[model samples]
Target: MASISSLGVGSGLDAESIVTKLMAVEKLPLTRLTTRTAGYNAKISAYGAISSALATLKTAANAFYSTKTNLLTSTVSDATVASATSGTSASSGTYALEISQLAKAHSLSSRVAGASETMGTGSLAISNGSNSFSVTIDSTNNTLAGIRDAINASSTNTSVRANILTDTSGARLVLTSKETGASNTISIAVTDNDGNNTDAYNVLSNTNPGLSQLSFTAGGNNLTQVQAAQNAQVKLDNVDLSFSSNTVVDAIPGVTLKLTKENVGTPATVTIARDSTGIKKVADDFVKAYNDLHSTIVKNTAANPSTTLSTSTDAASTASALTGDSTARSIDRQMREALRTVPSGVTGALTQLADAGISIDSSGVMSVDATKFQKAVDTNFSGLQSMMDGYGKAVNTLVTTLTDTNGVISARTTGLKDSIKLLDNQKEMLNNRLTSIEKRYRARFSSLDTMISGMQTTSTFLTQQIAKM
Candidate 1:
């Protein structure tokens, strides 16, 4: 009739220990499920690594496509004079670049006056190139600083930037054209409210007491031209060329020249040629990418031959999850096959990767032969490029098939995931069964403990009676 708080309290037997051992046996399936899940997860991670490496390889291969393989480099004899950039359309040639004058933006300075001096109310029409905007000068914004702010804040004033420059002479309103070139000259015309816009009497005045003094037009000469807007003049290959801006793009096909300084008599030579180093690097990168992908596959699918297995949980310590996996094997096989197959539309001594100085070793690692590759690039650049383009197209197609939604890798990953989900469900059911088994074991052990305790008490009474007799 007594209630026991702890297991095995009423009996000499260790009921708790027995129940724990029984439960451990009952939960064996759960442990197996856990191990299987871990294996599946490791497989997924291995595939992820392969996917990443394969994607990089795909990118490297894509660079060999016909549209992307232009590797021209431009060089300048004198960087101080000008720097040049060549594009795909640029033909290999040498150009004589002589910059006569650098394009200048038109800048005009008003007569210096007090920073807060109030000028007569009027409207000023500012023109730069074909763009023109009007700024109204009122009592609210008639001072030199106020006018500068108003002009800058004008919604339509996109061609000119207005600022007030303070010097010992005084504060002068400076207007600069935003664009450079002769046609972009800044001219300010005034509509004075005072009815005397010319202000010829104050033409030499530095104060600019009226808005008319701000005019720099045919009708009036008020604002002084600090810098003129002139086109950039250059003699490219002894041909005089004029550009609106200092950055000349149309002067040469696919070449942009940035004129930094004027070198009138001395001409700097610009050479456009095939970038042999860049071309070699591209070839090297393709080979390296393949090697990396190959390494990943090998590492993931390698067989562990040691009899003594590692107990470490680290993924690297254990046999790879992808070991003996059909998908991994197929990927490796397909990739190697792709490398061995000759690219279509490519003919010559440099038709295959090996011909272009890329070769695979016995261990399935690809390498580039620098000497041979350089020779191929120098002598058979077009042929090498054609081979690369064809190979790139083939490899890219293979990778796309392997990594696509319904691809081999994806299907394998999905199958593993499904297996994991099923295992998880089975584990849940097994856990529930183990929970019931533990409850039954505890109940049975409690009953056994109660019986043993009652029997022992009876035996002790009997022994006392026998001793008394």
Candidate 2:
């Protein structure tokens, strides 16, 4: 074989150019395969967009049909006094609420005289009526600030929070219960074992005294109970109820009541009703999502202007990559049919989307007639829900068929991938064949160049020999 670098050197013929031209012709089939691979890849991407749009539509439809979408609103005449939250289990009703007192946690402040004083080098034990935890008071945590930090850092000290308050006199230790219930009343006791120093131990003991030391009259310590640990007191419709916490759940079936202030003897009316605003928003979202999906389908399936036979040519030449595709056509057709047909599970006057103020037009896009929808919601709320639920099921089914693992989109994607792989194999085979052809062409052209050089040499020899004759 002749070296590629010197193939045309012998005959001065442009053999490299000739071989390149031949190889270009030979690779025609590979070019076609490459083009086909690109087309398949583009189709896969188009399907991805289609599937994504359908997924959005499916999510909206599912939300519209959910039973939990039946929203309820709680209205308190005076939110300043109290507020409430309502769920699906809550029933529409009015209740007269009179809050006698708000639940409070126990708070105690030590005497202001020795406010900056540190006490006790032993363990401070706290009891929450039933449970007890101890905070160690060594030299490292012997000061008022250290003891406060030790109490806060103790894993078992979950029932109470120790704080230090500073004023004109000095800083005093303040202790408060973590819970509001009466059973969570904080009991403080101190025991000193640190022989190094008794100053911290003595100070803590003087401030807290003991669990039975409820009065601040002993040791000049002003241990005053700022607030008592008490349960919330409320009279609902003149019926009394008590709770350990201000936020009460199941106080009225599915309603949660939060007492902000005490309004004794004065009644605040609380009304629970169906939340029309929330329900309407769900419907509006459904319409918007459907329109978005419809728009995607229209844009992708619009025919080129040259191919259009109808009067409509809003989307002219430069048709989408998905134009004239059967899958695109199927999606458009099925979506329209699903939106148009009344749900099989729904009955009565509010059976169709249009009955609930949602209408689909020739463009296959949905719009909400807010006035009519509100009327339908007010007139036959349950019936409207049933219609939406049933339609949502149908839309979900369509999306599942198209986007599922064994669905059309997956199958099409797999097919495109296989085609690309096959094209790759064809490209490899063509490349191998071109390699052999290039080798043969270089050798044959080298022989021709050698023959032409020899022929010119022989002609020059014959002319010299004839001139000598």
Expressed as tens digits, the lDDT of each residue in 202-232 for candidate 2 is 3333653222222232233336687888999
Whole-model lDDT values for every prediction: 0.84, 0.76
The alpha-carbon RMSD values of the candidates against the true structure, listed in the order shown, are: 3.7, 6.0
Of the candidates shown, which would achieve the greatest lDDT relative to the real structure? 1
Model 1 lDDT, residue 237, Cα? 89
lDDT for model 2, please: 0.76
**TM values, all candidates:** 0.87, 0.73
Error of 1 at 138 (Å): 2.6
In candidate 2, stretches whose alpha carbon ends up further than 4 angstroms from where it belongs are 1-17, 67-84, 91-100, 110-125, 129-150, 164-171, 189-224, 233-242, 250-253, 257-277, 295-348, 359-364, 369-371, 393-408, 446-469
Clash total of candidate 2: 9
By TM-score, who's the top model here? 1
Q: Tell me the tens digit of each residue's lDDT in model 1 across 1-469.
A: 6876678888879889988998888887787779889889999999999999999999988886642335788889999998888876677789999988999999998887787987778788888888888989888998779889988999998889989899887888898999999999888887877666544336324455877778888877778899999999989889988888998885789988899999888999999888888887787788888889989998998867762344544443468778778889788889989888987788888777888678998999899889998898788767877888888899999999999998988998999999999998999889888888998998888888898889888999999999999
